[model samples]
Target chain A: MYCVETDHLTYRFARNEPVVRNVHLQVPQGSIYGFLGQNGAGKTTTLRLILGLLKKQQGIITIFGKSFEEHRLQILREIGSLIESPSLYGHLTAVENLTIYQKIHQAPKNRIQEVLELVGLSGTGKKKAGQFSLGMKQRLGLAIALINKPSLLILDEPTNGLDPNGIIEMRELLKQLQREQGITILISSHLLAEIEKLVTHVGIINQGQLIFQGTLPELMSRREQSAGIVLNTSDSQRTMGVLEQLHLGGAVESSGVVLPFVQKEIVANIARELVRSDIAIYGIQQRTDDLETIFMNAIK
Target chain B: MHLLNIFQSEWLKRRRSLASWLVVIGGLFTPVIIFTMRMVYHQRLSLPQKFQLPDFWQVSWNQSWESMALFMLPMGIIMATGLMTQLEYKNNAWKQLHTTPQRMATIFCMKLLIILIMLVQVFVVFNAGLYLFGILPSLLLSSVSYPAADLPVAMIMQWNINFFLDCLPIVGLQYALGLHFKNFLVPFGAGFLLWIVSMSGLTWEYNYILPYSYTMLDYLVLAGRKIRIGTDIHVMSVMYFAVFIVGGYAVYIWKNEKG
Candidate 1:
């Protein structure tokens, strides 16, 4: 069953322009769903709608098979979120901050230290949060979200403003949580490459519309249908003419020819034809599976 | 356990701040200044009335609680108001607290109770300071003059309790103003405006509604019977504490927007 489902979720601010226009999403249980979009593309808005932070003007948001607004508190108990930048009280220490959250959740003190250690924030309990670096603050925010042992963790641009090492650490931590605890994660990122590395399933959204939603393999399969083999040669003009003689409308670049075909046999035939025509093909390459290709294909 | 956990964490957050320490120390200064000023006044008056009366001025340990009204209580209220408003303005503290499973009412009460404890500490120390200063002198002067009247001392003590009760509304109003205004200046300015309006005795009846007005009322009641005639302190305080706390909290919940 889908851990989270939004059926035609629509939201409009008071200005009345539709920010999120009938977006649909289905995140299966134990799936690491990467929500991808550019800035102001309503990724965060959709997450907020699911969390019941913002009311949906027109749609239904079901988390764990329950409506968000009706069971907001109970739903929130099951799902933890790190919305926007980690907004926290600056005056409190790391431990103090965690303690406040634990008190609210009625979690045990042992779990507080355990989460602190898990986030690599142990023994820094005395340091004020205001003094923490951005990376440390982000890690601490993750710790707060993890303290309740939530079944689902929603992170919005979790790696924003982080160093390369910080990003890697965050990615590893998220994967670790999923593996160890079976926690479903819905992480939003504008960078497709980053999500491609960590996410098993992805939902590409553009202009408030969910363009694609499926497993990585399924997305790869879609690209496989439109897959092209690029043939590199010194005489690009001759190669173009030769391909045109073959009645193939392939893309001609400065150094190579891009032949679009679904079948692997078609690529072999094209390669043989090139060799038979005495076309010195330097290289024959098939398109590698990448989110950018799927994203461009979906949006285009 | 939940409230205690919340309070301990909240207290740890503030325990290290410079401003919080200043408030703790500044609270002590209010009573000290008032009591010392009274000591000089008493000395001067004693000199003038020395020939006619031997015991014209007598310093008593019981008068220390009275000194708190002249400075400490109002200052404590102002400090608390500033702290609460600063918490809102400086950070997204309210939103942070609001999102917790703890209800809004619980958070509000937690803050209020903490501030009350801090203020209570200030009062206790201020009273202690006055006692140290006044007790020795009162005892020293007892032999020189006729024995001090215990009745006046007991009456002053009773009036001081009523006086503290009367000041509750002032603290409540300050709390309400702090919560109403998101900006620090408005709450601090309101505290000062309350001070100015309360000190000007032109409209005693209406001005008495102000929390700071109780200081003047405390003075008047202690001075003579004219002020206490028909003014039941107990009933007035009960109404203020109930109405102001409930009213302030209600306004907070009504006006406060959840992020």
Candidate 2:
């Protein structure tokens, strides 16, 4: 069963402009679903909607087979969240912060010690959270969310502002939670490289629209059959004219200087034509699979 | 169970706060200082006159309470308002705690309990200090004029009864203003300004209307009046406290509705 599902979820800050527009999302139980988006792309907004932090204008959000509005408290008890940046009491210790959370939840006192150890914050309990390193603070925030042994964890930009080592640690912890605890995690992150390692599924969003939703293999299969080639030509206009003359029109990018097409022999003809047009040739290459490049390509 | 947890956590946190401690100590300091001054000036009073030396400086439970309320009672309320409201906005401690499975009612009541505890400590310490300096010394050493009424049950109960009734509305008002305005200065400044105005008698005409006026209970005691019921003071205090309780709940609901 889908742990979380959103059907035609539409939310708008303005009358005509929707920040999250009819977005459909499915998160499988015990799966780590990576929500990929650029800044201001409504990733955090979507997570808030699922958590019922923000009111849904139009849509149905079901978590653990229960509607959010009808069963908010029950769902909230079962699902943990770290919304936006880390919101914590800076003056309190990591232990004190968790203690406060523990009191509110009426969790066993032993749970605090266990979660502190789980987050690798066992020895640093008494140290004030404000004195913690940025990475430690991030982990403490996550630990607070995890204290109740929640079935689903929703983290918004969980690794944001962390160094490479911090990112890796967080990534491994998320994987461990999913693998051992059988907890489902929905992580929203702009750092595609980090997410690619931990996520079982991905949903790429841009400008409030989910452009792609599939597994890694499915996405690769969806790629165009023809390998992409970047051709540097002197007369970009003449090269385009030659491609049309040769009837090899796929798409021309980069001010018409770089032409991408399916046919390889077309490059030789196009290169020869550009040289004959008295335009200097610089370089040419094939496009490899990279998230940055793919993301640009997808949004563009 | 959740309410108990909220109370324990809120109580422990308040105990750890240096600001809360400062207010508590500051609340009792005036009584302590006055007791010291009274010891120095004991010789100045005529034996007959000293007998009625206005339990003002006497460090007994009843008299110390009267003196403490004169200035430090309001100070304690100011500190409570500052600490409680600032927790919600400045550090988001309130928000962080609210995120847990605890109900808002529990958290809100825990905060009210913290304020109540602080108020109790202020009075308790004031009484303790009086017993040490004003009452104990007089009973052990010698009586100057007035017989030291240490641990005077009837007077203590009467005084505290008036104090609790008088303090209820102020606590409630401070809680409401503090929660409503996240800024420490606005509510505190308003309290300070009202205290000054009521002392000056300009706003004393509308004293019953202002929530902070009940802290002026000592003024009635200074005028040599016995505690009575169904007076204008009692009626006004009940009205102000009712408003405070209703307004505080409104603020709590309003705050919870938003971010």
Candidate 3:
């Protein structure tokens, strides 16, 4: 069974503008689902809807085969989350902050030390959370998310504002949590490259719509289908004009004009047309195999 | 979670917060001022021919209530509750708190109760400071003598209970305002404005209509300003508290954006 499931989830901030539209998400058990979207692309809004942070306007959200409305507390008891930035009391020490959540979850006292050690924060004694570095604060947030020993962990932009080292540490910690504790994690990020190495499944959102959701390999394999022919021309504007006249769909890029791979005769004809128009041709290449580039293009 | 666990969680959160300090400072401010003034003027009250609990307790109570009931009590509740409520928002912890296993009702009630408890702590400290103000005069000044009648424990306890009741609506009002606004000044400003409006109506025939006026009105009645109105300020305070507290919770539960 899927660990987290949603059906026809739709939400809008204003009446005319929908922030999330008809998103059906399935996060499998024991998998790191990468929720990818650019800023304001509704990734956070979708996660919030699932976590009951925002009221569900039109959707069915279920975790562990239980509806959120029927068993919200029970489902929430089995889940842990860190939305956007870390939410912490700056005045309290690391242990103290974790202790508050421990008491709230009624978790065992020893779990505090265990999770702290898991997050490499056991030595951060007597230091207030406000005094810790940004990376340290992120770890403490993860520790709080783990205090309940939850089976399903939901993190939105968990690695935001982290250095490369912090990102790698978070990736390793999340992997360890899944391998050791058998936890299912659904993590969101705006950049596919950041979570490419860690996620087993990927979901890409853009303009409040789920454009893609599949396994990482499945998403990566999409590069084969999106490969395009690149044209380096002197007068790019005239080249685009000729292509548009010929009903060729092309997008302007910094390197050159890129269009879907076409036959060699068609390319020669285009080159001839460009020459007739007094446009210099520098190079021609057919390549778009970079999955990051493909998805990043799709998201944009 | 059990009530004790929730209480412990809240207690630990405010360890180094402004609300905690407000309780301490707000409680002891009036008494410290009284103590300093007594020492400066070398004031001494002679033992009257007939000295009872009134002579000993009334002097301290009335003197303390002059400022407490008029300004400090209402304004202090406004500020303290604002600080306490803003603690979650200031640290961006409301989303964290909502994601927990606990129910929203439980959190709402426990958080509000914690603010009320903080107010009671202020009352307790202020009461204790009054006793200090009473005793320190005799110790610091050579001529002043200890009152012949002992401290009226039951009377002062009753007095505190009454004052606390009078302050409840203010607590409820500020608590509601604080929960609604993320900025601390919104509630403080609203409370201050309402208190001013409430004070201006003290002479009007329908002055008892305003909840903010209850604290000062109770004091006015105690100081022999007969209102001749049939309405009981204590009952009205309780009623207004119920309205604000319940209305606040209802809005909280019904609203979409919790965190």
- Per-candidate local distance difference test: 0.71, 0.71, 0.86
Q: Candidate 3: what lDDT?
A: 0.86
Sort all candidates by DockQ, best to worst.
3, 2, 1
In terms of TM-score, which candidate is strongest?
Answer: 3
Regions of candidate 3 where Cα sits further than 4 Å from its true position: A235-255, A259-300, B43-54
Instruction: Evaluate model 2: give its TM-score.
Output: 0.84
Per-residue accuracy of model 2 over B140-259 as CA lDDT, tens digit each:
336553453334557665666667667777777778788778678988887778667655552344555555656565445544555332346656777887888687876676552223
Writing each residue's lDDT as its tens digit, candidate 1 over B1-259 gives: 8678777755654555544675557556744665465456657646223323422222333244344565556766776656755664565555445445555687678777766666666556655654554333444453323334332446445665676676677667677777777777787787778777776752465545555667656655554436532365456656777787898888877652444
Backbone clashes, candidate 3: 0
Candidate with more favorable, higher lDDT: 1 or 3: 3
**Could you give candidate 3's per-residue lDDT for residues A80-161 as a string of tens digits?**
9999888899999999999999998899999999999998999988999999888888889999999999999999989977
Candidate 2 Cα errors over 4 Å, as ranges: A12-18, A219-235, A245-247, A250-258, A261-277, A282-300, B35-67, B93-95, B135-147, B189-203, B223-231, B254-259
| lDDT tens digits by residue: candidate 2, A80-111 | 77876676677788888888777766778899
Candidate 1 chain B: minimum summed lDDT over ten consecutive residues — where? B50-59
DockQ of predicted model 3:
0.73
lDDT of candidate 1 over A30-97, digit per residue (tens): 98999988888889888877765564678888889888767766777777778777766677788877
- Candidate 2 clash total? 0
The 10-residue segment of model 1 chain A with minimum total lDDT is A287-296
